[model samples]
Target: MAIFHTSIKTFSRGKGQSAVAAAAYRGGLLLSDFVTGQQHDYRRRSGVVESFCLAPPDAPRWALDPRELWAVAEAAERRKDSTVAREFEVSLPHELSEEQRAHLAFVIADALVGRYGFAVQASIHAPGTPDGLNHHVHILATTRRIGSEGFGEKTRELDVGPSGKVQVQWIREMVAAATNAHLEAAGLTDTIDHRSLAEQARSAIERGDDLAAAALSREPTQHLGKHAAALAGKGVATDKASTNDQIAEENREHYDFLVRKAGLEGKPAPVPGHEPVKRGGRVFNAETAGLPGGLELRGVSGVRLQNLLLSSHGHTPEQAPISLAEKILDALRDVEEISRARADLAMEKIRDALRWAQRQLSSQGETSELRQWVTNAALQVRALKSLIISRARRLLNVKSATRLRHMAEQEWERFNADCPPGSTRYSRSEWTLRRGRRLSVLEKHTAELKAAQERASEGELNAIDADILAKAELLAGLPHPSVSALRIAEPKPVPPDDLGSTRSVPRGPTFH
Candidate 1:
């Protein structure tokens, strides 16, 4: 499958990130940052297929070298807050040959240079794996325009703003188009989409394929950073990586069940909550079995679903009670609705935060501390919204759930053992005064924000009204048509040279 993956990040000195270090790691080279007096050597790193740098036509020839280019970039900027470079990491399609992949990367790099005039150092990497997957590229782009003289001013248009968002969208679209063209040329059928999973899900729903929409709408797993990913690839499991593995396993099981259900396409619909017959074999409920078609059990309690499937093909006495496919389809529809609702809630929170932020920016002046606070608050709200959405998508692992249940059971046993005879332990109230205080604090903050916005609105209206009055007074003082004709008839047009001289035109009536 050709999966789409692209991420953009900045290499900034403020965040303690060095362009030289980033360049060395991606290009598999040895480089030393002169400004920071630190050395970065990744020559021993494996799986780097190809690496090269691209620059503008007028850029010096030496600028094509990664070490020289980044070192120059670092030395040019005196500010500690300077952004040295922007990096774009994209996963290349494994379906294409190494040559084709390299070509695709160059095309993207050329587009980046053409659009932003930033120098790009692109590297294609193919990690060695059992499946020989994980082909990807890293494109480190200078944050400034490269000229014949050297690096010019920073490309402020590519900073965080509307223009930057448009630039990102253009890059994503261009990559998708280029990848599709190459796939077509190679006579391959697979394609990749640059859109988010939620967007793809919405499109599937509009196309009337709810099943596909559900499949496409799974919550995305968290991205493991380079070090974590490398460790996990080497069979070392971090906490998040382990959670992702469990989720992947669960999804695979669900997908296989769906596939098995799909095989029984023409079968009759299964009765909901059907009980198993116990004459020769035990029958499992369609819903309880969590399978698309119901399974019949043969003289066994607590047998695994896989074992039941292997044993029942020849030995089962009665026809399978219900179609598992229909049940699975129903469950998918339900899950799809829940996922859509959650997505809608997340979007609503984001929209509200954006609206509030816009209002704060527009109403408050540049020097207002309140305005800055509002801006920070808006950012925090947006971050919280994202956290909420991500948390909502997280599925509870079966093993974790079972462990928690066992822990609770043990706690109950201990509590009963410790209880005195004929005495009872009353349940504690879940709500507390601390919770109330937090709620009150939140309410106070909301009230303060509302009052501030009201004051800003009044000030803006007053300023607008005063400006309107002044403009009206100025217009009232302007000469009438009759007076203007008299003035025009009295004066001759000034010559070109005299216009630059200290010559003055006849003055019109002035407003007080």
Candidate 2:
């Protein structure tokens, strides 16, 4: 499928990013960073199909060269922490030939230069080896406007302020249009969409296409980012990629159920609404599989019908035996159970670390990295729990799956009702992360209160004291009194234990 992917990230000194090094990696060049006094050489880098630099008309001649361009760009920023550039990543259709993909990239680049008036360093990368659908473009753009006189004022409109998201939406729409135009010109029927799956589903429903709406209503796959995609190309699985694969399997199983339900009801076409079955659900078309035209296959099961279906297509008997679907489901369930148990144990360790980190946060002068790590770990746990629930959903029928969630909510409520006082009335592992974040905020306010006490006038001190007291009560869930003397102990580093995995059992005739 021609997928739609557009993301814009910043090259900012505050985030430890350098435009020169980024350009080197994206364009596969060897460049010296004047700002950092380092040489970045990516000339030996492979898989870069094409790379070029774009300058706005009337820009200085020196702006045409990427190395000099980024040097000037970094020097132009006066702040110790300033945004050097912005990168726009756009995915190209693998259905298009290499030349076609390159052309599409150029069109998108030109549109961006005209819109933003920045020098664009664009690179077109070849599709990934394992899965060939990752063909994409990397466009590094200056954050400032440029013209005949060279770089001008910062493009504050593009910064994450009032108009930032609106500008991003315009870029997304423009990219989608340009991609579809090129696909149409190349005589390809497949077109990409910029809107989310839910939005697309709503549009389908408005157009009175229930089947298309139902298909579109399924949750889309999570993005396998650059690192994860590279890992996948090397045949290494990531938690994110594994979760996406499981979601895809569940979607297919649901679609297969719809097909069977339609067949059993003697409908001309499959719509939606049904109980999903096991994994490895493969759809066999009557025309393609050489079955009788309009033949219903709802009740066709067991070894005999399975063989007939596979024999018509000349598929290997091991490819998709009827029992293999159930076997794969059982295997997946086993993997899910094992994974959930491990994750729950890991969650306890994370909670303990979180509690320690929160206590240490007040004393550490340089805890930005630790704070970010804490946030990332919390989000990771949330995603892990979601994937586990999704696995359970895939194994059960519709009502059972829905009830599983409702029951979970009820159980959590009951837990809270039975929990002792001084608690947050929530799951401790989840509350641990929340409390850690709140502790950071409380410490900030406490410091502010002390600082204000030292320097503020009477009126200002009174207001500051009131705000601090409220903040301490709300943010820290602590009692009144003793706002200062907040020195805390340092946290010792303890490396996390790596997780192990159990592979899914392969399928063959076990004579089920």
Candidate 3:
């Protein structure tokens, strides 16, 4: 299958990353950083089919050389926390030939330079694993624009603001479109989507396939970094990746079970223990509660029932009817469970973003202004965490309410079922009245659940947006080197330390 995978990351000194090293590794070359005096040699690396640099039409001819371009980039940056380069890693379809993949990569690279004025050094890598799958390309782009005069100012559109997101979206869509065009020309049947998992699930539901929607609705996993991915590839389990895999597998199993059960009965499968019963006069007790055949009545009280039916299900005692309280309570419990899962996922993402920002701050020499910014960001993260915790507490309440409601509903159903048809204990007219009341309560509860979900989603989006903006501001505040004085210098060796031996010291201080 052709999968859509694209990741954009920056190589910044703030994160202790070197642009020259990044270029060498991706381009499969032996390049030395003159500024840091560190050599990056990856020439022995296999599976790099092709590597080349792309520049704007107005760019100087000298900028076409990857080693020269990256060396200049390293020398141009004076700040300890400067953003050196931007990398776009994209997965190529294994179905495509080596030539086709290379062509696709070049097309994307050309688009990047043309649109963003960035000098792109692209490398098409063949699969390296034993199975020889996962062909991909690495695109290293200069932060500054290149022209006839020299490397101009940094490109802002690809760095921050709403424009940055738009650029990424444009690149992703272009990749998918270009790949599909090639596949279509080759008469291949497979295709890929740039939409997220949630978006895809919603589309599936709109197309009337509830099963497919459910199967696609699992929470998307976090990206595994290079080390974690490598370990996982070697049959080692990682905590986050393993948990996500298990969740995805469970969703698939549940989908399969639902499909098979539906097929056998030629109808929608009912939830276990949710089917209507005919028995009557059964009292609520511990024994009845434990049985799967009917609802349990042990450890239940009227106060608990009222809490579940009236409060948790969004109904008042006067508005709620006793007869259908069980159904409403069950529905409310389901909503709460789903909401809790979503809240937990949102919290995880916020925490991850905070950790990443903190790491960047810790790597660089801090200033007072930077410290203030970090403090503000930390407070925002703490506030978001508190909100999530508050929501979780509410969910705990819902769980308690649901337990009580289940017992009451079960006992009531049994009592009515055991009564004779004409018995006063099971009045048909009263049952009909209660059913109508239950419907009204259910509608109210449904509306509340929908509102709660929307609120949660909004909070998650807001948290992510704020995180991005804060991080961008932090990066923008970092100092940059004066582009006018940048000079391409040769790599120099470091001076050796004297060990009480008669070794001659270098005349001038060597650039370490």
Best by lDDT: 2
| TM-score, cand. 3 | 0.49
lDDT per residue for candidate 3 within 6-77, as digits (tens), equals: 989899998999989998988779998998788999998755667888887557766788778999887878
lDDT of 2 by residue, 77-105 (tens): 88878999899999999777554676578
lDDT by candidate, in order shown: 0.59, 0.62, 0.60
Task: Compose the digit string of candidate 1's lDDT tens values, residues 364-460.
Answer: 5222333333333333333333343223212212222233233334433444465433434322332233234334434543454444344346465
Using TM-score as the measure, the top candidate is 2
- The clash numbers for all candidates, in the given order, read 5, 1, 6
Per-residue error (Å), model 1, residue 223: 1.8
Report lDDT (Cα) of residue 229, candidate 3: 68
lDDT score of residue 328 within candidate 1: 28
TM-score of each: 0.50, 0.52, 0.49
Model 1: residue 420 alpha-carbon error in angstroms? 62
How far in Å is the alpha carbon of 355 misplaced in model 2?
Answer: 73
